[model samples]
Target: MRLPCILVLFLGCGSPDQVQPEIKQLNEIPLNIRDKTEVDERTATVNDTLPEGWVDVKSLIPELVLDIRYATSDNFVGIQLYPCERCLLRKEVAEAIAVAFEALRADNLGLKLFDCYRPRSVQEALWRKVPDARYVTNPAKGSMHNRGAAVDLTLIDQNGHEIDMGTEYDFFGEKAYHTFTKLPAEVLTARRKLRDLMQEVGFKHIRTEWWHYSYQIKNYEVSDFRWPCPGQAL
Candidate 1:
């Protein structure tokens, strides 16, 4: 049976040419949180200690590899946006991620998250650089990342290498879409596997990004909460 994918109001209103997983009408907001003045550590200091309702994915499934792109300059932003590499999600969302990870391990394939629980301040930073809603979700409406309900991830093989998924993580083209099937059979199968696994665990996907998934089983508000970095004030 096919799992349900509720198109929440957060879906951005874009033309058919626009290819974003979550696009919303622009509702800009001023940021009131700390910026990247503390991200230089680039350390993964996340531990069992967490916020009241958040759960660190590392704590739940330590074995799941983290390829946090924003912590490094490898992402499309081309700069370090995160204070550190901590994949904190809402309690239930993180649990669903853990379930997906274990299920993938049964086949020697695993999960590696690229982005999770982005800070509102960072969202503003991204908007400043690429204020287009087709790629960056407006910080005002707040993407699933701000709500700790979304994840950007890819599948890894038994050798721990990311399998081919037609395009890179942040490719802004039709090739990265799940509906774009003019590619190798293996790439399509890989995308389908990741999507199926995420949906099975109560996560929903967007059309334009194969690696994007949001857990919508529960409702939550957008937040400006940045994860506590080592030697930094929370």
Candidate 2:
């Protein structure tokens, strides 16, 4: 069954209450998408090595751009939090994102992922640095990212340059809020296009962050499993 659409409209007020209803609906929605374990079972014969419900997105969508900020020091933390640069998500979420990419590609646009499927341990470490819930969710409570069902990404143009979204990824401020509309007209248009496309593909946007989206059709537990780093002992 197809998931019910969750439309998020921003009024440029930066009020969390405006987005709370959608967030609440995310948990209340009945399961419409296939379970991750089921997907794992079906794909087991095709590729038996990957963990159930988890996939490296680049393998499924090769043309999609990946700039995993946490794997490098270019993020807000200014530290390499991840072991490597890879975009991993629950199998269903990955597939949905791949479809979104195809839609974007048809328009000569593309996606550039910043972060995905963050390990719970990493969340704890991040909390240690920034304990405030405004910026980092407490690891004890966990986040959609810990469940391999969330993504931080932005749109890229045909030339592969990231389209302006008012601020850079991981910018924790009012300026990063989807309701903040004092930016250039082009930036607003880019953000809306991305938001509309992602929501159409079963993803929901949070109020505070323009680049973050979480798949809502199914729920998964927070995980501590870390992806292997290149040339590093597991």
Candidate 3:
């Protein structure tokens, strides 16, 4: 379903260049903890030990491939948003994704992740660059990615070639919408297979983006913690 424009605007109001100052102000705003149970239930307590309930997808499902476009300048923004090319997701969501990967494996296929678990700060940077609700979600409300409950992904064949999905990942147009038909039969079939597998494992597809899906069984808090990058001094 389409997110309400008013909500998008209300939550994501500033421009990209203004992100630093806005982030400073946002930090002053305390998290609402009245729903402590909700936070406790969904928030993964991460530590150096690689705690339970939150995991790096690559480690858990080695066969699943990662493109992690945000880690490079190939994305629409033309800026490297992530310091590393790691796919982090809540434990349950990661497990469900693993299940989907196994399902695809039966057909000699695998899953390729484009994006996952985006930091809230990066969301602000994206807002500053795009500033359009049509393409990017407002950082104020936080997206499912920020919650570690969503993923942008596609399917790959046994040879590791990407299957056609009508359009490339992050294509900002109607052609990328799941409802936009008018494509080759193979492309449509590929999209259907991906959607069916994701839904079967409890992920919900957004109508506007064929590659995007959010886990439906649980909720999570928006997080600003950035993953550590390689070569950084401890």
Candidate 4:
């Protein structure tokens, strides 16, 4: 969904109270991800570092709050699919996210990333579990994420709490739609805040997921490799 989101009305969600919590962590994966070394020999990326033209978002924004869901059992698959929690985006995309995050900082806000730069092998694993193209992108055709051009993220406040956007991240269905307006004004405002900032930085939103964005300005080839986990052998 890297294409620019259709223009949304922003409502100065600078105040956390504006995006009040409707359902606390509903369908949300609690943030408990920690560093680990548990690569699946069958699917782990065989590389020792990020591939060329790729950069870990943390390198650009050390304070990046990465809740890489697939790295833990909290995701839809209910399994730890990644050996470690990392946010690898193409260099340009990573830069764009950094710029967006810095822009939000003036408002005392931040972006919490959920997913980024998924490996093709990981995409296949997701496809294996949820073959529905409507939910999981077909590994055959490839997702923009598979090409390191997409990200799943949400907005956060100064205290590092998620700004309620009505539903939680990765919650599929009608309520997740970008146009699903049957929501509190603040929630709509919060969603618009995220869309506007991301779009300003050249990211696009999908109609169904407020947290998903793509880096359509530039494209990269799909990769089967993963970033090597710390303490994992070469």
Highest TM-score: which candidate?
A: 2
lDDT for model 3 comes to 0.74
Q: lDDT score, residue 208, model 4?
A: 78
User: Positional deviation of 115 in candidate 2, in angstroms?
Assistant: 0.2
Tell me the lDDT of model 1 at 66: 91
> Over 4 Å off in model 4, which ranges?
1-48, 232-234
Each prediction's TM-score against the native? 0.79, 0.80, 0.77, 0.79
What is the clash tally of candidate 1?
3
Better of 2 and 4 by TM-score: 2
Score candidate 1 by TM-score against the native: 0.79
lDDT of 2 at 162: 94
Model 3 lDDT tens row, 112-158: 99999999999999999888887789999998999999999999999
lDDT of 4 at 183: 96
The digit string of per-residue lDDT tens for model 4 on 1-234 reads: 222223223432222223322221211322221122432221134322666777777765667899999999999989998889988888778777877777777799988999998989999999998897667899999999998899999999999999999998888787988768889988888888787676666676777787888875677888877677766542
Candidate 2: segments with Cα more than 4 A from true spot: 1-48, 230-234
